[model samples]
Target chain A: MSEIHALSAGLALDASVIGGKAHGLVALMRLGLPVPPGFVIPTAACRVFLETGGLPGGELAGAVRELEAVTGRRFGDPARPLLVSVRSGAAVSMPGMMDTLLNVSSTGDLRAAVREVFASWTAPRAVTYRELHDIPHDQGTAVVVQAMVLGDRDDHSGSGVAFSRDPSTGERRPYGDVLFRSQGDAVVSGTVPTLPLDALATREPAVWVGLMDALDRVERHFRDVCHVEFTVESGRLWLLQVRPGGLSGRAAVRVAVDLVDEGLIDRATAVRRITPGHLRAAAVPRIRAAAPPLPSPDPASQDSATWDRAGSGSAMQAFPGSDPPSTGSSRPVTEVGSAASSGLEILARGRGAGPGVATGRVAVTADGAVRMAAAGPVILVRPHTSPLDLHGLAAAAGIVTTTGGLTSHAAVVARSMGKPAVVGATGLTVRTHDVVVNGRSIPDGAAADADADADADHMATDGHSTSEGTTGNDQTATDGRSTPEGTTGNNQTATDGRTTLGITATDTDQVVMDGWSIPEGTVITIDGTGGEIVLGVAETAAGDTGPHVDRLLRWAAEESVA
Target chain B: MTDLTVLHTLRCMGFTDLGRVASAAGLAPEEAESRLIDLAVEGLVTRVPGAFGGWGLTEAGKAEDARLAAEELDKAGARAAVTSAYTDFMVLNPELLDLSTAWHLRTVDGVAAVNDHTDAAYDARVLARFADLDRRVSPVCAALTAALPRFGSYRRRLSAALARGDLAETTESYHNVWFQLHEDLLVTLGIPR
Candidate 1:
């Protein structure tokens, strides 16, 4: 068979031939790991499609013909149909930057679909992403046409993504969100809220067992913490894609060290793998515990339930201030007493880039945020923050963005500003009156409550009345700030009455401050390096957590033994 | 029946000084202020004190607006058209925000820096995008106005904001107008912030 037609065991082809995503898939296949049955249309075809202003005739036809021949189902047949996911896999992963059509129903239009996917490789948005990321424009994408594995096939079926370990803490165990009776796109799009990966153990024990076995095989094959996108159909497990080496910081360090200990790689190679970028990334604070709080039974845990209730509380209390009375936790509760006040909210889940959770009134606009510094601690939520958001960013206690990745502008700014940040949270809406938190709606200006009032009061008594925390220029409303800042900046000045300092507690662990009793589930972080409040303490010190990190390192080492 | 002349028009005006509110509601300032004071008496609206303050709807005012807007939408039977228009509004919303961000910040050496208003060329590029986005938004606004005549003021006010933005330095410029329009959508759709 011609090299292009070969389905397996072919030498590594350039991304141009197999496309970036499929090329990686082929590499995994070469390593003897399970991959869903699939085929690729070379970038040469895409280049031709773009130049000729349509799909190159014979290449797409040939590729589709081969796909149907292998899948044993007619394309777009409706019954026993061969559905496929057409993805834009450029050399660099520009997630959500390009278009991906899933469960495409037409096999006859497969060629046109491939061309469409190719054309999207240079859509205005995609072009802009490439410019922002400094990715060269001319390197066209290769299209991957894979026979779709139905994640929602039956009771035993579902779709999910799993990292051989926790990507957040680099702890070894299958870690990722899973949605029953859904497809890969649903998991990635985050439109449908997902359940904890552990739910699979009870919901579909057989599938969960199969998934663990597959993970073990893939981890042993990659000799690294590998992330997989998979689906189970009618009790059958199918792996769609596998990737290695996305862990960063402490997780990366721990993974590398463990790999050496397991004899999968030498100590020198492990040392080499810990790049300076990884070290710098590691230095960014994270939730210290490796294992996420065992997915709690709080109603907030269900993604759909939370989304259906989207924006309900943003107006009344968008901030859910870090120390606000816990709505769902077993803690002293304070009735905010107004329908206008949005109850506490879960902003979407990401890799937890920074190690803390905070609550502050959300500032949707940069100007509004600039003005907000005096009123209260503001959480700057945006589709994504640019250089313009810096003023708001400077004033915000936390930042949440709907667009961009770890390397996006918002993440960089949040890190630079030394604020708690969550980025790449999909389905985010930042309207003037409300902002969507984790798919839930919250009313605007609803966060002006007793908590913020107290924070304002606390700041004033501490003499940072200059700071103006959200009580609207009234120096007297600075009631809460004094209590929250008791052991830190506020108390230090209270006793001496001569301290010229502003914001006394700079320590990361002490971000909750000494006297302010932290409510259960409120995220807090302390920067060990700059002594600044990072996010939640869980996030800031995540790397130091033993269970999640140590377990991952140990697992990677054990996999290497196999 | 819903009052197109009253609630729907004010929904898009947001918190504004008397003159702008009156202009948005197509009433004289004295007339608009009288109605506003009456609404304030009902606890549906309030006149904020000081230079930075303005006439703003209370939480009750927002609820009332949402209830009345939905009724007006149903009365005119413009829900589908308005919903479609709202989707179109959503499309334009992001572009508007991008323009706003560009007005405030710029990029250099892969770093986001303040726009500083020194770069006329960059400012013009962003403004051009805004203009493009505005052109696309016109049809949707027109559709909305056709469904309810009260929405006609948005076309005028939006154009006014853009024109001022193009001609001179105005702090409450195009972005501010767009922000109000966005607020108008949430109120109209009864989607909380």
Candidate 2:
């Protein structure tokens, strides 16, 4: 009991001993959430392990026995083997910088896995993370060993990461990524693209209800926003991890204001929960919604037709600088331009990472991006980024990753740089120079080749001179070749000597002017809040600074005056 | 300098001026420039024409670098050691990106904003951690260099970057150097990034 805390309802352990993650897990268990049965080898055990290079001598075996009893499965058995995950939980969270040994068992004497986790506390990256975050290196990480619920074991199984609300807009609903028949790793790594969290409602309704209930309970208990990682095994939900209060910027402000109204927390606490950092982030305008504007962005009120409208906008929705036009709400999806005979060309849609609008020439490779950026703003599109793409990412105006998700390296870097980014745009093929999106080749008109040249010349002449952005850096050309009835296929040439240039918008709500076969250098705007990458510039209004933001700031003003 | 050295330098830098390529390759600018010309003639390198133009590898050059890098690894009998170092590097990669991000933006009030570099205190803290990271990776770089001599340039380049407090996102800045070095490792190991 002194060295290990069994994860059950009423054990009050501080974060320093059990670490932030384990502390959160304990909270989840106490709240009656469906957390997997496990015991935490406290940070005290980790400290001793660090000094002696050994695990808390007998705590691991005893904990495993208890886990076995709770899960009703034998560890390392050939038949129905009980696999468990060992994760490092430091007092401070340094994500993606530590080791996790999953599927550990007794045959390897579990102690080795325990030691590995302990030793990982000082692995080069983890050490750097602590130093950067001002965390004391001496504070070790607690290892939480829990029985693994196989997310990929059956048809009704899955894994997902859910936020109490949309991290992008602070919308009060369970929003997250769900991977069916896969493990938690896919959900975290974002390498394998996942479905919207709502997909769970249809696939495994019971797990979905349990997850929704768990998110609600966690929000009520924390009195702030939170997210959780969970696995559904054969229709059974098992919560793996939970952390509270990660909403930022506008989302953070809205959540605080909403919570106060919901009477979860007092106005003073709500004001305190939001900081000036969140205000600045909120001030950053998001891409206007692509789906025809609903009364509000209520996912419940949305339908397949809404996505069709959002995805079908083929023309310029709004002019640049002036509040871009909104796609009028009355349009039906079936009446999309005659070109919509093929499945709607989704130019590119991904999980929006950082919030803002940017339009630029698409650069498929880092070299092309850096070179293209010198001429004008470049949207760096990649299958996925590695450390190598840093220079190109820096040079570009916005970032697009066909792979990776919110926490991927690209997402983290993009947010840090305050660059608008769209990630995990599935089915996007960055074909050398041309991009194939939503399974359609683009820019199939010979007339547009000469027009594209004229447009480029115009942009080169006018974009810098007439463009009125405060940043003084957006010289991205926004001309897509119109009148698209020409040769279509790979390497198709034109009537003229030049090749075809495609222009398309990177947006959520598709308007009429937008067409399937866009030319290159077509400027598309990426909205981080609405998670919309609109063609041309989507309208951007000032931050609503409405009741929620105003109340939060008023509380701030009142506190300062006090 | 050998043609492979010139071609690989261009490969690592992505697109860069002659001065940096020479420095990265440990050759005089003239030596690198002369070899680059020969590479261009061989269709392994191309000079982009524009304000942003620099000597860079063509597709042929990248294919050539991969051929020679794989050859170099096989000939030296160091694929196992280099591959092992790569595994360790991947572990550190995310944290490095995290550090770069912390440098680029900081949470102010409640929003993420660009770090204006006005806060010497904050910048210093980030730099100190960067130095600490560099210190830990030194041995890994040393191990790779011992296995493959070409990797020695990375340590020299990174150490020079660390000695200076310059970690900006410019083309030749410390972060970009580390980025190029990371690419060099992957290219040498024949791994797609």
Candidate 3:
């Protein structure tokens, strides 16, 4: 039986038997990647247990004995006891669709613990998810039980997640988040602000090296962008889960072509992998250059900092000239006073949906969002939004929610509002008073200024893809709200005209033609697909089909070595 | 309850002016106006002084209403019953929200695109979902009425609002009685909005 297979290097378990996550982990292990030791109880056992009105007597007891024998520890023992994470994994990927309990002290209560995990497959939220995703309801979940590697075990211990490749730009580099002394859920939860995966080098060199090598091997084996959830315990690394084919848009196109060029997969498979939906998603507009010009205050009476932070431009792209430091170990430059602010941190990198970063002050509460309409632009932050938050929904510049799936209240509302949003940031526990991102605790009051910096960076970098801020002389002042520092980078289209005082920007900021100055009163067209700030509301372009995206498609058209 | 006090309840009910809140509270307009004046002194309620304006709660009035409503639920010893009803309400809350979202926006090919209102069939499907949710919510309304007689008014107002396509009253539609029910639940539970 699939249940009897040891979750080791060569266990012949199907997705149906071990669930998708454990199956993928086993695949990685087979491919010689670093995966933690774990075993999966097949969905059949779950079915039998539920049918018989509790766990079958011998199966669970036998498994527990085996676990004790293998790990050389008893469950829930005070002295050197073993703890495990029990999670539900369906044959299909039903992310967050079932219950997951972390840090369960495995003991005589192991059966009860397993039952709890199994029962979660039927929660209202999970049921709704299945209904929307078209997954069958009767198909139960397989349980993956693994020895808990405490990410918070010591200073040297922490948690992180990594993609075998940059899922955003389809760059051939490992990308993810790393938090020292945290748990696997900690990284997924967004409870602690996470450093870039590269930070692992400075923090834990051996772990970082192992991770990078493992990532490389996994990428080669999967021949596609793969993501791994992992944790480190007292300097030792452990892999929790793995998956492939979770990319979309430009990144997807790029990977398809690049894999063929690397002789991994052939062009036909690449073509087959990309659907029309992928093409459509890729063409969504984004902010062109990081750091766009700020608008003049309507009244000087407004809190300068609130307005400064609240300014729509605060979420602008990163300035074009900035480059991501090459070393994996560069520490964050703590800008004076910036340490207190909750500026933007790149959480989990994904293919930029629609581009063009615009930042506004973070609005934590629904009431705060409604009151913000008259004040300035605001980004709505919530544990998850409900219908009651409609007034705030109507007024937000963007949306960031800590919980729910992709089709959640926050995501739907953000799409309706035509705002940039990131959802399913599991670890974000934002209250009316404070918010958490990447494990960093940020007071609500400090979030405003940080929002401004984020906006400036967002406008400049276009989703942190390029560190280079605003580029060269192509800058054309849009509304004559120009800053003296506006240096245009290569091939930039800036709307800023230097009619005002002190402002500075690095060279290479792109400056484009003044199509029509989008003044405060002048309602201009914003193409979420093209990242274009245009003259008037125009018909949606058939498609931009930009050269950058086209190059990716061209590569996908080639033959694969695999 | 005092006649004047019942009249003032109509004032906060809005639009139908003094009569609606008064009738719902089982009072007369003159009596309600007298109570409204007393409330006005406290700056709890106000008159709009226009053809469109009638009686409405000021910020303080809204707070007072919430406090008083919660006290009423507690004093009646119906807090447990109301709380149970509220839990049931929470279950149906998202379906209502989803219907509202679908009404405002349309999803095509898994990507939620703006609902330009081009597709009649899609709109119908969403409305059907709203209808389904409303049916589900009826039981909660009945339970609330069972807990407290005053809550009976919500059932009438909500159904009337839905029948009239008042939009807000239906689910997420503006006239949505659901919003009022939500407000009432919060007030009953002593939970802040």
True contacts kept of each: 0.00, 0.31, 0.03
* TM-score, per-candidate, Cα-based: 0.59, 0.77, 0.66
Which window of 10 residues has the lowest lDDT sum in candidate 2 chain A? A317-326
Best by TM-score: 2
Instruction: Summarize candidate 3's per-residue lDDT along B107-192 as a digit string, tens digits.
Output: 34433344566887666665555566677778888888998887787777666656665533222233344655676677568764
* Candidate 3, A1-562: lDDT as tens digits: 3243457877786788777877887887887766656678888877765566566556666776787788887776678787777778888876544667777775555677788877877665556545544568777888888777888989999876677765444567776667676665543432233466777888789999998887877777878777677788898878777767555555566677678767888767777777666677555454322222233322111111110000011000110100110011111222112212322222222111123344454455444454443455655656555544554556666565544433355555555455766543332334212232222222222223223222222111111113321232213233345321213111121223212211222143211111111112111223222222222222332334344346546545553433
- Each candidate: what lDDT? 0.51, 0.62, 0.52
Worst 10 residues of 1 chain A by lDDT: A322-331
Order the numbered candidates by TM-score, best leading. 2, 3, 1
Question: lDDT winner among the candidates?
Answer: 2
**Cα deviation of A88, candidate 1, in Å:** 2.3
Encode model 1's per-residue lDDT on B113-162: one tens digit a residue: 33467867766766666677778789988998898776687788779888
TM-score of chain A, all candidates = 0.60, 0.71, 0.65
Per-prediction TM-score, chain B alone: 0.86, 0.95, 0.73
| Error of model 2, residue A431, in angstroms | 3.1
Global CA lDDT of candidate 3, please?
0.52
**Candidate 3: regions farther than 4 A off:** A1-4, A50-54, A106-108, A186-192, A290-542, A552-562, B1-41, B45-62, B88-139, B149-171, B174-184
**After TM-score superposition, what is the CA distance of residue A106 in candidate 1 from its true location, in Å?**
3.5
RMSD (CA, angstroms), candidate 3: 12.9
